[model samples]
Target: MRRLFPVTDQTAAAETTEGAPGGGDREWSLAELAAAYAYPEPEPEPEPEPDHGPGGGGPGVWLRANMVSTLDGAAQHDGRSQPISSAADMRIFGTLRALADVVVVGAETVRQEGYRPARARAEFAAARQAAGQGPVPAIAVVSAGLGLDFSLPLFTSPLVPTLVLTGAAAPADRVAAAERAGARVVVAGDGPGVDPARAVAALATLGHRRLLTEGGPRLLGQFVAAGVLDELCLTVSPLLTAGDAQRIAGGPSVAVPRRFELASLLEEEGFLFSRYRRV
Candidate 1:
């Protein structure tokens, strides 16, 4: 495998865990990772006012998007993301899920990835409980068309009921089918497409304030466009796939460029785990 950079001793020492997949080469330790990528130091601010404003002006949920890409900026090698993933990446992926209240994703990704329900991991059990979180975070799928497979395990067998976000104009039959299949359907917009802002609001109203989005590109673009994306945890796979694969964030190009500040970078087996937060 091609590596963009060599692994450091800190990451190398923490390369494997008991029974974790890719034990021989994976580099992951949440403690070490936290120490490595703690969100950048904040600038001094005046004494903060109470954050209890009315009508969506209050302090809302924080959005963090996790995406993986090749060193050359290809989001995927095939039609799926696993083609460019590593064991270290999977560890970080699970850790992020363990820390979130909901894992937001797009419908296309759900289908393409054959996503299953987020199961409670034994390792994160005590920590999750201490943090007042449920055994597992809920899966929230963003779909404008409501054209999802209601029978999928992701909808029928989740630890928490899976959430389906759609617009008010979505097909009623499909929406009803989703609800009947043991899914929670939330309307985010009155038009055909889901309003990214409203999607965050809906999840927030449900008491899911720590939102994590595992984007399928276009979905991330929507979140970026809405200016609701608060942070991004990106993994740079050390491969060069010379193809027409997409970038991490797709869809229509943003009219204005949005910038995120680098928080930290960690590496193992040539993979660079990076954290960037909206400035």
Candidate 2:
């Protein structure tokens, strides 16, 4: 078996020569030594937003969520996202999670993604604490009529609070069931359905200014069509899955156009992670 080594012969020779005494045969000029030892200048940090006068609360922040698909546009492989995410992609996911004050998802996504709804690492907990937030960010689920599993880890996890957003027509029994499993239910829309725009306003009133939405496409399209989403973070996997499963956005064939400006693009392990802000 061949073992992998990080260091090369050139680096080894440099280390050995640098460690030799003045009596050694090799000698270097002052400029040569400085050039070899010079360190790259550090990049400047981004500026922080200044605090505005406190009267009216801050505007609601909306983040559109969707995973980057293959060239064929498939969000998952065999009904799961794990196959599409690499180690570096997982790290980026965690970093995005840390930046949000709340994590929002559609009820279908919560069930499909096998969501645990809590921080899986101590670093995430520590980061939340440092930001004067709870040990885990709140997990918010948007549902219109489907019943959720009360026994799931999302409802039972004591590390974070759960919020269920539903329409006015939601049954009292369903709300009671969610509450029994330690979730607060918020009624947002008229009749018996959830309105994405109203839900954003409700979340803002509940002190969740920085929101991150991880979606299952229908929700993403709804937010986009409603003109509420402010930003989008997508991780494009390299693999191809040719099948009629699901795309990043699913709905009627109607055209729903929304303008967005690219914020940044990152490539890792042949995968592209792109960030965009709504215009």
Give each model's whole-structure lDDT.
0.82, 0.69
- TM-scores for all predictions: 0.84, 0.76
Candidate 2, 161: how far from true, in Å?
1.6
Tens digits of lDDT, candidate 1, 1-279 = 112223455434434434332223434456544334333333343444578443334434688999999988999888889989998788788888887889999999999899999989888798778767899999999999988999989998988999999999999899999999999999999987899999999998898878999998999999998899999999989899989998999888778899988766666777877778788
Looking at candidate 1, the ten consecutive residues that score lowest on lDDT are 17-26
User: Candidate 2: lDDT of 202?
Assistant: 90
Best by TM-score: 1
**Per the 3 Å backbone cut-off, how many clashing residue pairs does candidate 2 have?**
0
For residue 83, give model 2's deviation from the true position in Å: 1.7
What digit string (tens of lDDT, one per residue) describes model 2 on residues 229-261? 777777788887898868887765446577788
Give me the displacement of residue 246 in model 1, in angstroms: 1.2
Model 1 lDDT vs. the true structure?
0.82
Q: Model 2, residue 100: what's the lDDT? A: 68
